[model samples]
Every structure is written in C-alpha cells, then in structure tokens.
Target: PLIVDASSDFFSRKIDFSNIALFYGGVQKNAGISGLSCIFIRKDMLERSKNKQIPSMLNYLTHAENQSLFNTPPTFAIYMFNLEMDWLLNQGGLDKVHEKNSQKAAMLYECIDLSNGFYKGHADKKDRSLMNVSFNIAKNKDLEPLFVKEAEEAGMIGLKGHRILGGIRASIYNALNLDQVKTLCEFMKEFQGKYA
Candidate 1:
C-alpha cells in the first residue's frame, strides 16, 4: 500500500513507516509545486528490483543514486521545496506546523459538525483528512456547486470536490494560516444560513 499521508502525521505525531515498502506524494499538497513528486522506497526493496526492466525514470535507484537530480529534474519545484522546508523550520518545525494544521482542521470540522443537519462530513470523524476537508450540505448536491462559485467570488479558490465525489472540499493546507481558515469557517456558516 502506498501509505499516502501528506500530513506526515505518522512520523511527526504518531507511529512510523519503518516497514513500509514505498511511499510517495506530489509536491503540491504541502511541498512546493503540483507536478513534482517526492518518493521514498525501502533500500532493500529497491535493490531487489534492480534487475527488473522498469524505465530509468521509474527506477528508484536512478533518483536515490543521483540525489533527486536524475535527468531534467523539476528544478524550480525542488527549489521551492527547499525554500518551503526552510520556511517551516523557521516557524518552529513540524511540531508547530502540525499544531497549526490541527487547529485549522478543527475549526472547519467544528463548523461542519455544528451545522445541525445543514452540513455533513464525508469521512467519519476519526477518518477526516487534515489536508482536505471533504463534505456535503446534508447531501444537497445542488448546493455544492453554488458554494464553490460563491466561495470563488469571495476570493477563495480551489474549494471544489473531487470529480467523481462531487461535493465540497475545503483544502486547508500548511500554507493556509489561521485567519484564512477562520474566513473559510465563516464563509461556510454564511453559506449554510443562506442556503441550508
């Protein structure tokens, strides 16, 4: 299983991935850009696949041996990743970052949970995502699109649901601070009052 945890909560706040075969995630979530991906593979597992006929680009050794500079790497994205990492450390490392993320997610989840049948969260409370908050307004499908539109008009963008799971998705990533998250919670409340 590709344990895709962009929050990295397991390592920072909980358990470890010491036994996982591989893990990978795109740069856009909390990294630097959207196109680039950061991959991590177990050394022993990678060695076993050395004789396989996979493309060089897919070969884990090509990246590990070259230190992620194999071929025409996404230089700009890598730079941004470095810069963002430095920025996070300046703000007090993953502990602080995770704390802020938890607070942001809590605000939005509280807003949804307190909606009194007006809004419904996609995941069970225990399974909610810290990176993306997926939900619906009491399964009122029509309201989701309107919410997205009005939210865009109000200066917040990318608050759309997945294509197949059309609903509301408020993705409060590490880059979004507390004030912005509060604004989103406020917007959700206002939208609920107007429609739900």
Candidate 2:
C-alpha cells in the first residue's frame, strides 16, 4: 500500500493522491492544532486489513465504519481544525496559501544565501522545505546558542533547531505573515552585522 506521512507539508499546497492508498498527518504543523491526526483512506483499501485479529480500536475498517467515532474525540482540537480550515478557505484556499508559503521561504533562503558566508543553509537549494528553514553560522558555530538566545530576546521564539541538527531552524508555518518573515530577515542581518 502506498501510504504517505504528510506531517510537515499538510495543507501547504495541492497534492495529487490518485495513487495513494492511505494519506495521513498530524494537524499540529500547518493545520493549527494538536492531539488529532487526519487520515484519508481509499474505500477499497479498508477491506484489506492486515489481520482480522486486530482490535477494533486499531482496525482501520472499524474507524472507517464508525465514521471516526469509535472512540471519544478531542472536541476542542477538532473545533480549532475547523476554524483553521475556514481560515484557509477565507484566504482563497491552498493555492493562495502555497504562494504565501513559497514567498516566505524564499525570503529566508535569500537571507541565508546573501549572508556572505555568515549563515549556511542545511538543505540543498532545490531540496529546501517551505515550512521549516534550517541553517547555522558558517564560521563561528559556537555562536549558534547565542543566536538563539538573542532571537528569543527579540521576541522570536522557537528558532532552535532539532537536537540532532543542533543549529537554527525557523518554522515558517501558515500562521506567520510576510511582515513577520521580513522581521526575522532583519534580525538575521543585524545579528550578522554584529558578529560577522
């Protein structure tokens, strides 16, 4: 079965799922909520359970048959998801959202590219992610912690990268506006000027 995990890019753009048997993702990233996972399964695929011995709670067919109400749901999170959907619709849907996301990511990538080697991007240019921009100091790697500290002081929280990566990561999710991104770019410039 062709299953996909769209955790990062969910709702960021249009996806062609014609060949997918199951598409699922957590709503916390782009969908503006937590504690809920959205799943889409082809109807015919539900008939091919891995085992009939599987418990109802773990069975795809059980949940599908019950319309996703086999158990109690996170009511508040579901409501927030609905509100987020309305927001996306009000903003003219995924196409428009995708454009904004692309613009935001490009602005950050440009900052990294024009940093004069002060900042280096982790991903190759073409393989970069629109949702999260990961980068680090090009020369003084020791200053990464200080950078994250100063960024938080400037009211830009959560710029810390993953523990394994141990650098800077700015998550430019759907909720961030272009002006906010510009502010971050400005911060990057000022930070570079201070120490570069």
Candidate 3:
C-alpha cells in the first residue's frame, strides 16, 4: 500500500516527502544498473513493522540486524552500486549530475522550441520530464517512423518513442552525456530539414 513514485530522475528533482512512508528506486539512473533497488525509510516507521513477523527474506529488520550480510546478498549488484557511487562522488556528487542533466534537457528543448512548431512535444510544458523528453513531429505523421529509422541509421539507439505515448521520446538519462545530446540534436535538425 506504499505509494512510491520512483519514476523521475532523483538528482534532477526533489520528491515532496509530505506524507510518504518510504522512498525507493532503482539505482540504474543516477546510480548504476537495473538490478539494484535502494530504499530510504524512517527508523520509527520500521519499528512499527516489528510485530508483523514477515518472512526473514522479506523483512527489512532481518537484513538490518545482519548489516545487510544476511543470507548471501546480491554481491555483484552491491559491488556495482559501490562502484557507481564512487564514480558519482568523484564527479562532485548529485549536484553535478543534476546540472549536466538539466543542460542536456535544455539544449534539446531549445532546439525544439526553435523549430517553430515543426517539433511537437507530448508532455505538458510544465509537467515535461527532465529525464525523458517526449515529443513528436508536427504536421507530419508519416515522418515519425522515418525519424526513428534514420536516427538509428545515424548511430543513435533508443530514439523510438514509447508505445503508449507514441511519436518520439529521447530519454536523456544521467548516463547520456552532453555530447550525445548534441549528436541527437544534430540528427534532429537534419531530420527536420528533410521531413519537416
């Protein structure tokens, strides 16, 4: 029954913790691989679960009591998470990550805005996600598939938009560098010139 919205990039934005019982997310974005999930919980809230008698594997207290060394933990995953955390700390922590991600998203949005309605965005302007830039081709429904195809031909992968949203979605996750965004923007401009 815990409502956890671990959708957005953590470093790029803050989560309002007004009434939340727990905060949990996969470490793949700001941290590392998809196999690791990190959780943040209040100690007082944890005390309330003491009488629940959940299975040892499912109980946080069991893991805490054993210092997370209980029953052969995911060693490889934890190692990877440590490596990622070290790398993140070396890069000046989450602040630097946030700054870089913001820059990349801004660059793409600037290009889209300058397109003069040739590029259409899917998400609302205010609610648009910094991690995933979703948009579509304006007035050219046929160009959507071509855009996906040509982007792939240009050495860009994962440019295809999500199925439910349709159109084009550029997921500018933290792992994606600014140079990659520039490369994508160049391709976008080229595609716009050809199809728009």
Two-way lDDT contest, 2 vs 3, winner: 2
Runs of candidate 2 with Cα error greater than 4 angstroms are none
Give each model a TM-score. Answer: 0.89, 0.95, 0.85
What is the Å distance of residue 108 in model 2 from its true position?
0.3
lDDT of 2 by residue, 168-191 (tens): 999999999999999999999999
lDDT by residue for model 1 (140-179), tens: 8778889999999999999889888778888877888999
> Residue by residue across 26-139, what tens digits does model 3's lDDT show?
877766677767766667667766866687777777766787778876778889889977877777777787788889999999888889898988877787778999898887
Task: Summing lDDT over every window of 10 consecutive residues in candidate 1, give the lowest-scoring window.
Answer: 6-15
Model 3 error, position 52 (Å) = 4.3
Ranking by lDDT: 2, 3, 1
For model 2, what is the error of residue 37's alpha carbon versus the real structure, in angstroms, after optimal superposition? 0.7
Q: How do all the candidates rank in terms of TM-score, highest first?
A: 2, 1, 3
The TM-score between candidate 3 and the true structure equals: 0.85
Question: CA lDDT, every prediction?
Answer: 0.80, 0.93, 0.80
lDDT of 3: 0.80
Identify the runs in model 1 with alpha carbons over 4 angstroms from their true place: 1-15
Alpha-carbon RMSD of each model? 2.5, 1.2, 2.6
